[model samples]
Target chain A: MHPLAPVTAVGRSTLSMLAAIGRVTIFLGATLTHLVRPPFYPREFLSALLSIGWFSLPVVGLTTLFTGGALALQIYAGGARFNAEAVVPQIVAIGMVRELGPVLTGLMVAGRVAASIAAEVGTMKVTEQIDALVTLSTNPMKYLTVPRVLAATLALPLLAAVGNVIGILGGYLVGTTRLDFNAAVYLTNTVDFLEAADVVSGLVKAAVFGFIVALMGCYHGMNSGRGAQGVGRATTNAVVSSSILILASNYLLTEVFFSA
Target chain B: MIAMQDVHKAFGPKKVLRGVTLDVARGESLVIIGGSGTGKSVTIKCILGLVTPDTGLITLDGQDVRRAERDAFLARFGMLFQGGALFDSLSVWQNVAFRLLRGALKRPRAEAREIAIEKLRRVGLTPDVADLFPAELSGGMQKRVGLARAIAAEPEIIFFDEPTTGLDPIMAGVINDLIREIVVEMGATAITITHDMSSVRAIADKVAMLHDGVIQWTGPVARMDTSGDPFVEQFIHGRAEGPIEAVR
Candidate 1:
């Protein structure tokens, strides 16, 4: 194959992907803009809070605990070679507060919350309930999308904070029992390593990830195609896109906060 | 009143509505008859702006519907979907009062619930059913709840897309009677799309047959027997042979 031929094909494919992304970005922005305007539905918002927030706590909490305990064991094993095992508690605290806590919680919630929202809304769209809402003079964006987005945005940060505490506690348990670290020393090291800025930054990341997850779910659902296959594809796309964006965004945010 | 002139809609290679045109005067019930996939529902969807026509003008009460504010234009019409499309999350009364509970029509919750219960009664449903969710109700009850919701706002126009599609004859007749009674009582213009001859006879003042992306024939329901169009004859009588070809 000619080098020019391959270059042209690559460019075309990249352009098409960019165009698709642009369309979704514009759709999400318009939906968010509609969210802050009038024609608000309080009942729908309450239902979403019950569905997305309250129902999501147990799963998110469990994910955080296991991840924290695993992180503590890994850090202790790695530091043992250099006799830097004393650093386990400090590193685990900083790690949970700054990175694993928010990002892991976000990924887990996105898998559960985002996929379900997308599937439910997509099925409703395919079945013409969205059209029925429009005919009933209810804006679909306001009635369906806004409440989910709002609930996720407000609820995820709180969930992230809870996950962070649970994860650190898990790390403490592992450190005290398995590694033979003094409980008092472990607690002091953890306290000394974690700063308010780190926790605040993680919460901020959680909020942003929440917005992305909900936005992706609603966008894919609204633009889903005609049948069951269409709904399945939308749900898959919502989860994949949300997870990828969360990880990519975590890196960018970490760089912004720590590098500068 | 609703009118469509030279409407056209296509999905890629297949043209669904090709220059389809018709009109429904105020208080008239027009039943559009057609074989499956012949665009009866598409025509109603076009008028409702759920599926925008590629070209043509749709007007309601002399106002250009396609160019008007969508929510306000839609506010004048009520639609009973093929499956009833009731919101599963809401109680029966809330579903009925969905419109009145929000936006400009927002009412006190108690007042809205009372109005919902009254509408349910109008549709032959009891007050006790008002607290049940859509999923908890039977198919006929769901249809009645959908009808109650449709008429709750007292819209000027109503569209019924296969309103009796999945019902047994008895239940279908009950829904047909309810629709006719509501239309006449409200004096609302009604457009119903169905292949059910019983429904056509019960609800329509005028009947139009859709075939091959166009209106094959249209006239008062009394003249349906002598429509003189082979497609209409074949469809109305449920015959396998005529000008209409049945796929093997």
Candidate 2:
């Protein structure tokens, strides 16, 4: 191999990564700019809210329920070593409200809403529908990205709030029925343990996660290459990128909210 | 009038349009013909500012297309895409009335629907098809719907990107004739990109052949049969062995 071959490969990959980052940054700026501008499509925003928020509740609920139950069982088992199994209710409540609730809801949405948005918009791009929108005196950023992004940003917090409630209830159920704890005491312990900061931070994380999911979907979609394969690739990229960003941001936000 | 001067475009290392130049007069139908992947679409897209050229100047009515206020400029033009490109989620009437339902040109919903129905009828589609989604319609019906949408706002310029592509021969002829009638009636400046010889005969006032990122020959449609340019002759006759090499 040539002596410079390694250097060339590394340089090329680095440039490609930088280009991708540049494209995404520019797209973020464009989306934010369009979000504040006039000519908003309320109908599109409402439809996106329905699809991204309302339709996603069942999956989010089920995921959190199972997670909360399993978390309660694990916490009880771990606490039993110290004769502290009574901490299950408080631990489960804190876990559900502070971390798992928002993070899991985000991942679920990254799977559902992100992939759907990418597929829909990528297909539209492939078929020249986006160009058609431009020809029709419509700015695609305003018509498509802004609405989806705004809807997701506004919807995920509500979804997380609902999921948090349902998750805490799941833990209560498990703590009482499965672990032989008193139901009323489990409820009181959970209520006493979770502060407003915990719940509010979770909701804040949900909002940011929502924005990431929608933004990744739109960015991948608007830049989709050219055919069925391109659209498929865009959908996969949307899910993968959004999920990674969600997990990474979860850590950072946790640091900001809870690190002491 | 629209003009493109030495427009150059490339996607990475593959050059699409290289020093391409062309012009279209007001109330004239200029049909660009070429082998697949010869930058015909890129040329039109450059004019529309959908695809920016790497280097060039494009002017419509003596003003640079990119410098014009976007909405006002786009509102003066219409486009019929190759695959119809109808918004699948919208009903046919909504697709047709897309421009009229929003932006600076917005009209009342009832009025937009009425205009959409009228345009649909003009494109030979019945009013009953107005409520059907693009996905529910046949390919031919979809193209008609796209054409209806293109003409709905009565723009001063119309672009037809392979308007008859994917249609049966009869439907292709019908669409060509419809396009011809519309262009003549509207007296709009028009640009069409297609390889179909029949589309050329039916719709072109002037025909330009694009090849290898350049306009090989352009002239009145009547002179096309005897244009004497090898590229034009080979393309019009659908010859495989010629200056134009088949990609495969």
Candidate 3:
């Protein structure tokens, strides 16, 4: 084999990845432009809010509750070795409010909401509904992506705030019962340890993550290939890409907010 | 009112349309027929601007369609997709009145719903069907609903893709008749893509046969049977052995 063959293959793959990224960037830009233009679809936006926000509460609540409880127990166990188990309440509250609450909720919602949106829209694309929209004089991006992205951005922060409260309550329950910490003292410690910046930062992250998640879903759906196999591929890609991007963005946002 | 000149489209290794050229007159129902994957649907898509041709001019009236303001240009046309393509979340009336409820065409919800019902009734559906979703309708009923939606705004032009593809013979006949009646009554120029000869016979004023990315034959529907093109002859007769090979 030629010495440059491996290098050429790597270069080709990199270029393909860049092309994919460029396409998504163009899609997102167009969606944002349409969102701010006239012909806004209030009906579609309301439906999306109900679908992305109100319908998502049960899952976000349940996931946060369990995660908080698990974190409290783990921190207690780790701190016990140094006879510093009293720190568990503070750590659990900070953990849930500062990072885990928003990130985990985002990941879970990305899997559920993003996958559904991708599959539904992808199926429609394959079945020619998108073309129908065009012929009907409706912009598909305005009719589809704008509402979804707006709903997710407006809803995810509220979901995250609810998740934070529930998650802190879970930590409180575990701290008082399993670890024998006094309920009032644990509550006071949690309140004292968690600053407004921590909560605000998490909500901000949720909003950004929400936009990314819904954007990925709409992008993949609108650009999905033909047939059942193509739709399946798009659904899977939407979920995986959204989740990975959410986590990576979470880390970057966290570093920006917290790093000295 | 639609014209395509020297339209060419290719998909990677496979070329779909090549130098396809045709013209449709106002109030004329033109049906294009060809075997599957022979660019019949692609030609319709190109005319609708859903798929842009690599090199060609598609003009509506005397204006260049490819360069026209897309939304303004598209507002004059309606399409019935092969699958009906109704929004699953929307009710029948909502789907039908989708165009009338937005942009410059916006109307009051009640008014839109009334127009939707009127269109539905024109296609032989009752007002009650307007409240039901597309999923609740039978295939034939869904096709009727699609037809109703296509004409709800009474567009100047309409395109129907595989209007009778999955229907039984009787339902197909009903749909064909309905299409003909609606097109005549509305005086709208219509383009239909299908392999169903019965549909071609029932709905077409002019018939164009697409083969290997070009219009191979164009004539009145009555002359389609006698067209001297070997490809059109083999296709219309549905013969297994012909110059067109069946790929395994």
Candidate 4:
């Protein structure tokens, strides 16, 4: 048994971790560099906008719709204990707008969009389609990564805005129909409760989350190993990494936006 | 014309190319033959600058490729990847006309489609196949589509990687004939990588046998059988015993 074997293993893992971070940072830098450069592919960009935005609407809408309803019920029940049951509209509005709307949408997109981008691009890498693009005098980053990232960055905020409206509607429906509250009163309380800052902050977080999701997808995909299993791993890593980054960044952004 | 001098490439500890040197003259067709894992693909990729050599010089028309503007340098070359590598999302004509619809070679959409259909015809495909997706085509048809895409831009240098691999003998023969006819008609410099002797015989103006990370034998296709190099003889004859050891 070598005395420094444990130390060696730790050192090896640390170095590999650092190397992976270095690679991801470099890929992110290259993506940013290409974003500003010319030879843009508007066709690819338009197609990506459709994939990451329009197709993603239903899932984001549905997820937020349910969460808003559930949140109204939970806040009502918890407030009942404090003899403050009527705060349902205010709490639900604030919760949905400030956190649930953006975070839930980000997670759903991490599952749907990130996995999709990773699998598609990973398969392209495996099949040499990416190399084929290179041989055709096209830069893969400019043609591929830039479009999806830009689209997701733009689309997520739009989706989050839609989700906010639908989510507040969900809370309104539950408050009025199920909770024995007047519709006009619930709507008034909800509108009065939410500030411009709350909505803007979530949308801002959504944009950052969108960038993270697409970046992780493109990064894992472009660097995928050579086969089905490699692509599968890339897809999984894309979802996992983006989900974690979204949550982590949400906290950091929230702190920056609302900390005392 | 393409030239490689003392090319070397390594992925981690496994060295793929070690001091590989070869040349193809202007408008000549050269077929590189080697066993699997002999760096044949890597050698081709190096010439295309897809794989950068650790130590070597690759030149095109007496100019260093590394110094060439990337787009202008790549514009002169067309490639048929072994797996076809067609964009499945795109229909057949779109795949064939990919370059013609984008980048420096871009044409009007209608013009690109017309040219794509013409290239498809030249490769023995019907105009209807142009509207179909790559997945709808058979393997041989896919290969033909890939060939069509390769020549769509009218490149000065054309690379066919394993042109006859995984095809029926008749289909392989047809593809070989198309490639030979295309190369000669276009007067393009061609480099094909294949282990298939028939592809070599049909396509090579000159044959270079790559083995052990270097050129073991190279001469006119006429001199291949009598090259007197053990590696070349053992490879072309498909013998079990050879100077070049098999992986298995």
Report backbone clashes per prediction.
0, 0, 0, 0
Q: What lDDT tens digits, residue by residue, belong to model 3 across residues B88-184? A: 8889999999888887788998999999999999888999999999999999998998998899888899899999989999999999999999899
Give the candidate order by descending TM-score: 4, 2, 3, 1
DockQ sort, best first? 2, 4, 3, 1
Report the lDDT tens digits of candidate 1 across residue range B115-169. 9999999999999999999989989899999999999889999999898988989
Each candidate's TM vs. the true structure? 0.96, 0.98, 0.97, 0.98
Among incorrect, acceptable, medium and high, the docking class of model 3 is high
lDDT of 3: 0.90
Q: State residue A90's C-alpha deviation in candidate 2, in Å.
A: 0.9
Give the runs in model 2 whose Cα sits over 4 Å from its true position: A3-8
DockQ for model 1 equals: 0.74
Pairs that collide in candidate 1 are none
DockQ for every model, please: 0.74, 0.95, 0.83, 0.91
Candidate 2, residues B114-156, lDDT tens digits: the string is 9999999999999999999998999999999999999999999
lDDT of residue B186 for candidate 2: 95
lDDT of 4: 0.93
Error of 4 at A232 (Å): 0.5
Writing each residue's lDDT as its tens digit, candidate 2 over A138-164 gives 999999999999999999999999998
**Candidate 3 residue-wise lDDT, A1-260, digit = tens:** 99999999999999999999999989988988988997788878899899898998999999999888999999999998999899998999889888988898799889989998999899989988888888888888988999999999999999999999999888888888888889999989999888899999999999998998899999999989899999999999999999989989998999999999
Which residue pairs show backbone clashes in model 4? none
- How far is B31's C-alpha from truth in model 1 (Å)? 0.7
What digit string (tens of lDDT, one per residue) describes model 4 on residues A72-180? Answer: 8998899999899899999888898889989998999999999999999999999999999999998999988999999999999999999988888888888888999
